[model samples]
Target: MTNMLLAVVVGLTAGAALRPAVVALAIPAGRPADCPACSPRPAGPTVLRLLSSGCENCRGQLLDAPWWLPPAATAAAFAAVAAGDATGWYAAAQYWIAFLGTALLLVDSAVQRLPDALTAPAAVGTLVLLAGAAAEGEPGSLPRAVAVAVAAGVLFTAFALGSMGLGDAKLAVSLGALLGWRSWQAAWAGLVLAFTLGALFAVFLLLVQRRSRKSTLALGPALIIGTLAVLATGP
Candidate 1:
């Protein structure tokens, strides 16, 4: 319990403290894009403000983010593995996997899109990280993670090929981390939740003018939400 609390504290503090830096990084340092999310009274404060705060690219939209969210997710993964059949290192890996998903979803949603720059590296990095984790710990889990990565990666890749952007497949790598070698329940639930949300988002577009009749919904956010939901439900 104490460790969980500490994790929560660290996650919250890091998220909040990092916000200014993130926003600062978003902007080009000199120009302002007139975003609706900003304070109108400021009348175009330096782009530095938004970039440092992670606000320029919709980073500010994460205002309601639970500070300890990542830590809590990590704790849950840890608990599941310790009490259930999963190994400790595998559980640790999933904690990060869940974090990456959740983080990407919010960031992409706020920006109204996901950049391939982010997704491409993430997909590759996740594979490398998982491979390393498997190598360092249990050997069998590596193969299982690989299978999960291929299955999930291909599924999302096919979806992107059919109707979405390529980033969707890259985002699937995150799900692979959570669902790999886990019970079938985790895999199915996460996948179901992601697509269900994606479909619902499409309907939402029709109801509101936020999106066009033909504009495709971003899959990064959907996958992120789905992964988080699965993580919360535990194995």
Candidate 2:
């Protein structure tokens, strides 16, 4: 009970910290410099400014991020902590995905693009944290994790030629590494679940006339959700 409450606090605080970055990065590519919604340089402490809403110059709400993000993040963190036996750096890796995946889900849903800025760092950090886990006596093979990540990236790259984006492939590398650290079956399950969820979502949109057959769906959120779901369900 105490640990779950702590997870809630940590997730909320981290989600709040992530808001400014999400607002800044959620813009379409090649527009950050001239984007009207991008907040100006903060005169006060950047952290305080970020935690506050609205652009300082125009007093406009930037990105209009939904109110549920922090609560969703808290739930995700609680789920991750409750779902697995991960400890040490392994546990850190779980929390990393829980928080950062929420950010990615928001950005991708808003802009239909996953910034390399976030994806690249996330992949590297997952790997580094997994390495730390290995060093801390976690019974996982780092080489297997790398191999699974590469394989997942390659598979997703193939899918990118048609239904997905290169960004999704990059995100896969990180998720694959995290899942593979647990077990090969977990990694495979995550991949399958991602595609299945994406397809179901597209169908729902079609049924509701929210999207057309020719419309492109953002796959990042599905992928992130699927990976996190696998982690939250146990290996």
Candidate 3:
């Protein structure tokens, strides 16, 4: 119990430090709505904005932040720490992945965009970390992770060609790798849960907010949320 708490606290602190990095990576060139030219904005100011309890785009417009933001981040950290592998190094890797995923969720929710800078690196890094862990413990899980990631990416690519954003497809690579490392069930659950949650939100928007199908909300965050929820449950 003590170790779990300590790990959770460490994860939380690390996550706080990482929040800025998330913004930096997600928006290497910030998008300010006010700027018609959409000039490139430095990451430092954006990081400051995020730290100072502000999530303004490059245009200095305030973005909508869900009330669950902070608590969700903290919970993600805790869950990563609690449900990660017994190996210390593997657990630490999982914690950082969760932290990064949290940032992606926030940025995607706010801007309806997911930068390739963040998603690509996250996918590569997760695979490397999981591969290393598999060499020590579950060897077969490594191949499974790769297969699932590729399949999921392809699946989401098809979805992207129609309704979803391409970034979400890229993100599926990382999410699929992590969740599928455990089992096919976990991978399927994450994907199903994401669409289910997204559909529910769409309904809410249609009814309460009166948003139309044309004004599609960011689905990456919901997908991330579902994968993280499954990750938190452990196998």
Candidate 4:
């Protein structure tokens, strides 16, 4: 119970700390082409303020963030505990995974782009952490994770060729690694759920917002949410 509390605390801290990065990713580069007279805001200062919670320049802008941001971190802490991983290292890894996942989800939702910086590190780091977990008496799962990563990457690559962005495909690799670390079933379900949710959301936008079938939409949040759901509902 104490460990779970600690995990929640850590998750919340990391989430808060990384909020700036998410905000930075969401902000557009330079001034709008039509508003050349407006001074361009560098992402660095905004990031610093967002992290410190003190930048007047960024405080108002931060209001654009979804209300779920803080709760998602707390939920990830509960998920880490629910995974039945009692070790400190696993707990720490869980916190980081959830933190990074939330960041990716928020950034992608805002900008329709997932930065490689977050996705790449998340992929490599998750694999490493799961590898360590497997080393500590768990076995056969790491190979499954790698295999699922490859398979998910291939499937998403196909989507990227047509409907989805390559960044979303890359995001799949990380989510797949995490889900596949648990079981092949988890990996399969996560992938299915992600696309299902994304498709449903696209349909919703089309129906309600009058968006076209070819309208741009961010899919990363759905993918992240689905993966997190599967993680929380452990095998």
Candidate 5:
């Protein structure tokens, strides 16, 4: 079990590191959008090329860099499910969360300016799983999963309302549901770490004059990365 956990953690880290490539492939520089970096009236192809290959100006603004993300996320989630005791059931849950969560994160952050879709569902899923804990029995019935999930949700909702362009309240539902009440503590801790890192990133961008005080950063990917990192950290 220890060895398996370690392996899963490594895989999660690797997958997260590769998500940018996957996102790029899926969106595939499909359409060109305004980039803050380019000169005024930059050509369509020129901007797309910069985004596809990763323009210096746009850098972290878009997740185009780690297109490997989707596949990598799948790998990490499945690995955790496989390595855990209830292989069939857990693997299924992990697969759905990873796939849906990753896509939702991208779409919402890019299109809606809100990354709540994925996280909210995950938190809800955790609660649903808990309600059925009796039916599932033993392993899945571990106490406090629902509580943890809810708590994490509440905590994030507070943060979301405080500094973002969107409501993060919904995100907690999914994150809580997926993580379960018992495991949510770990989720929050992971969030803290991810946010800290994310803050630093924002600071770095600001320091280099890439981002302005009003420039927003996508929170979904950071949450996803944080959640996975937390899960990876667990015993």
Candidate 6:
């Protein structure tokens, strides 16, 4: 219970801190990347601002983030702590994914695009943390993790030729490594669940008349959700 509470607090804090970056990066392509809220400001004040009423400069100019990010991030962290490996390193890896995955989901849902700024760092951070886990007596094969990541990237690249984007492909690399660290079956399950959830989401959107058959849906959130679900439920 204590650990869970700690995880929730950490998630809330981190998620709040991430709001500025989310507003900054969720812009449409070809637009200026500057965040009116935190641009030219140091990290300390930016984070502090998030804890308060947000930035004053970009009142309505920036993306209005959903109000549920902190709760969502808290859920992610709790899930990681509850279901992740006993070794602190593996739990840390899960927390990293949960944190960044929540941000990616929000950004993609809003803009229908995933920025390289988030995806690239997520990929690197997951890999590095997994390496730390391997060194600390975790029961996963780093080589297998790398191989699965490569294969997932290749496979998703093919999917990108269709409704998916290169951003999804890049995000897959990190998710694949995380799942593959468990087992091949977990990796396969995550992929299958992602597509299934995505299809279900599309159907829901259509039923509500929010999107048409030809409309491009954002799949990043589904992918992130599916990966997190598998991680939470997997042994």
Off by over 4 Å in 4: 1-7, 29-63, 66-93
Q: Compared with the true structure, what per-residue lDDT tens digits does model 6 show for residues 61-163? A: 4566566665566566555646643446666777788888888888898899888988998999999999998888788878989999999999999999987
Candidate 1 lands at a TM-score of 0.65
Structural RMSD, model 4: 3.8
lDDT (0 to 1) per candidate: 0.57, 0.79, 0.70, 0.70, 0.53, 0.78
* lDDT (10s digit) by residue, model 5, range 97-185: 55555565555455534434344555556455555553555344344655555566677667767775434556545554555533546
Best by TM-score: 2
lDDT of 2 by residue, 97-145 (tens): 7777777888888888888888898899999999998888787778888
Which ten residues in a row are the worst by lDDT in model 2?
41-50
Return the TM-score for each candidate structure: 0.65, 0.86, 0.77, 0.80, 0.57, 0.84
Off by over 4 Å in 6: 30-58, 68-71, 74-81
Off by over 4 Å in 3: 22-75, 80-90
Query: What is residue 170's positional error in candidate 4, in angstroms?
Result: 1.2
Per-residue C-alpha lDDT of model 3 across residues 1-235, encoded as one tens digit per residue: 6766776676567666655545444442455323233355444444456554334444342434444454457555566547643454355446656766777777787677788867887898888888788867843387888899999999999999887889999999988988778789989998999999999988998999899879968898788878867766753
Model 4 Cα shift for residue 32 (angstroms): 6.7
By TM-score rank, best first, the candidates go: 2, 6, 4, 3, 1, 5
User: Lowest summed lDDT over 10 consecutive residues: which window, candidate 3?
Assistant: 28-37
> Under the 3 Å rule for N, CA and C atoms, how many clashes does model 6 have?
0
- For model 1, the superposed segments whose C-alpha errors exceed 4 Å read 17-51, 54-87, 136-140, 208-212
lDDT of 4 by residue, 117-226 (tens): 88888888878887787778553377888888888889889999887888987888877877777788888898789879999999999999999877889999889878
Worst 10 residues of 6 by lDDT: 44-53
| Alpha-carbon lDDT of model 1 | 0.57
